[model samples]
Target: MRPSSILSGLSCAAFAILPCAAITVDLTSEDSIKSAASTIANGMMKFYSGNVTGGIPGLLPGPYYWWEAGAMFGSLIDYWYYTGDTSYNDVTTQALLFQVGDKDNYMPSNQSKSLGNDDQAFWGMAAMSAAELKFPNPPSDQPQWLALAQAVFNSQALRWDPSTCGGGLRWQIFTFNNGYDYKNTISNGAFFNIAARLAAYTGNQTYAEWAEKTFEWTRAVGLMSDDYYFYDGSDDTINCTELNHIQWSYNAGVFLLGAATMWNVTQSDLWRERTLGIWNATHVFFTSQGGQAAGQIMFEVACEPNNNCNVDQLSFKAYLSRWMAASTKVAPWLYDDIKPYLAASAQAAALSCSGGDDGTTCGTRWWNNGVWDGATGVGQQMSALEVIQSNLIDRVQGPVSNSTGGTSQGNPNAGSGGDSNPIAMPAAIETSDRAGAGIVTALILVALVGGAWWMIA
Candidate 1:
């Protein structure tokens, strides 16, 4: 076992106890980071009841969607990779495997009505991380990690719509879903992220081409601005005439790491320039001018300052923190430029984990100078857990490729059969099967009612 001072005497099962005090991380010490991450992760998992009765594996409770659960597992995978902590690995693996539907892709029948392309991609990305980091594989009979990721990529590749904005995946999968008319950055950026990582891992030219195509389409559609500020997305009903213009941390983060991965594999001057440009543009999210934070902490510039962030938006910074830290591994030149911001953000994020009954629950606002802000949820805890653990990026090796010791198998044609089709809604919902189609309909209705739910992701 990896040596650890905090977990030295404790068994893996004992790691779930909530902290009585707020986490403390000495960014310079690996042990301190692990200890702090352990507390924050436990605090975060307290919101999860997925494995208990009346709960579903791979699914979070009310107000939390399946996609966020996928994202949270991705962070947990990172936690295991960084700290050598196996405390949550079993649950993480269980959740990831349970979501891989019958086709071995992430398009489970239960999530079909509400599943957006981005939602499925989040789980696929987690599987990809498992493959790259050599996280323990599932049982021999279960779906493998790299193949699961490829299955997701293959499924999404078929959904690429050229009819509206030249070429881009719609925000939702089904033509009947509310966002089928909107082509958003997260959906396309997520596709790009997976494709680029696949290209890097498998050394496949086709994935590389798709990644390049997606980037060009995003740029041409005006969703990605000239200054590299990636906007939310636009509706295709107008032929992409109008843009949302609001920027999100995850949009920029998703594309930034994809571009960086492309550069890592191709070493093309063009990819290098794009990667650096996007990295530079990300400075907008970091405080540079005023306040006590002033260029230190990372904030969702569009919503955080106004205290208007929804549950999903609260977790956006987690991906931003995750991608920025992971990008440094692929693009080593980014290490110096990205480290300070992550370090300061980790410090601030940890301070915000001083709320909730355990006193270690995280809050949405990190700039509140250790004040709880009375906010507590999976997103807040997750955002804190991610940024805090990310400070260990420099301590580990970069992600690996097939040529570089990756063992998870891949299937280029994994999701092309009956499973590729949009999940069919049942003619009638039985009481016992309400968790299937009924929940899907409810989610679709919520999305339709929100109308602006696309903006939140």
Candidate 2:
């Protein structure tokens, strides 16, 4: 096996055929593997019945919203990618097609509760996942998955309001929401993620510039605090004069993944520093189960105890889970150090499943030690699915060799390791080398042996 084989993988069914030696965690148990994966395709069905059954696939039982559905489908897409089961992929495409409005992008509503910038951004992230992972194409009239994401990027660019905060987007596109004044981290971070990903997939300098602009604006307004902890938004009630320092797991997560994507595109130390700072802040502030910390567990610090997590709030952890897993490539310097925490969370979540022969419901509170404490919902299932999938990403045993290509991009305030400093992208580095081909052309020389159905550590 060659060194490049570790990051290079081809689609088998719908997933990249990763070399098994790269895998770290052991999934020796047949039942654990089944539960972890089936929960994705099956649990998603819990929301609505099909055409004959009289319900939509993406919507919740009631209160249908684009953001939540986008999240559920996002995790499902990842499930197919991780497990290589087309069954997961089929439903994901079907659901996305249902939600994409006549414009070929997501525009579920147009009135007072119409799509917000953040809402649209979630679907954009999913489309990027589809494009980057090489998911199957959609209908001819509809946008290709990559183009679908680009539509969102296009729309968001139009909404980018430079008048207020120099270069940040507002929270809502609809003026009726009374939130137009607020310049938010989620909206900007979401845009940053989409732009950074598109830049990586296409090697477009334009997207990279937008990615950097979004990051700079986000930082300039103090939304992504000097500490790298993301605040709620800029104080629009006072004409953008003040700052609100409320942090959410998803806010930090959106930035982390965006920074990671930027790191992928430019390999800049700024992105690396930003990635490390936000990641470390996320783990430190949003963790622990029960009385003790116990293996770096993650929790929704804002609404875990009182249970104030709204429908939108419920799925925030899912982004954190998936993005943290995706961040493995950006900060490979911390990849080895990060695996145990992912494994610990997944193990706790797996133990949270409780039910009869019918099915199992994964809970929110993972620290209960086999106790299902939180109410089961689509968000809960998404959280469990993402965590399990993260651990399932085996990247350790692949062939190791002396090879390096990225420029020495670093962060000014990278504190976790202490030594990271600022650096610029090298001019000689080839974009082809930075952005590897989306499709690896099979050549799956080393198989994980047991397939996703069953696997060993």
- The candidate that wins on lDDT is 1
Residue 174, model 1: lDDT of 84
Residue 265 error, candidate 2, Å: 1.7
| Best by the TM-score measure | 1
Full-model lDDT, candidate 2: 0.62
Ten contiguous residues with the weakest lDDT in model 1: 1-10
Candidate 1 per-residue C-alpha lDDT over 252-286 given as tens digits, one digit per residue, 9 for 90 to 100:
99999999999998888999899999999988787
Per-candidate RMSD, Å: 10.7, 16.0
| lDDT of each residue in 1-457, candidate 2, tens digit only | 0011111112111222311111122355534554566765476456645333676655555454657778777887787667766776767788777776666557665423756788877877787777666566676655567767767777677667755555567888778776777777888889888878767766667778788877776666656656777767764554344565556788877888778777766777877877888877886434565543464777776655444555555667778888887777555665775677777776666665543223366666666545555355677778877887776556322111112222212122221122232112212323332221222222212222122111111
**Per-candidate TM vs. native?**
0.87, 0.76
Error of 1 at 284 (Å): 1.7
Question: Which stretches of model 2 miss by more than 4 angstroms?
Answer: 1-31, 50-53, 109-112, 291-295, 355-359, 395-457
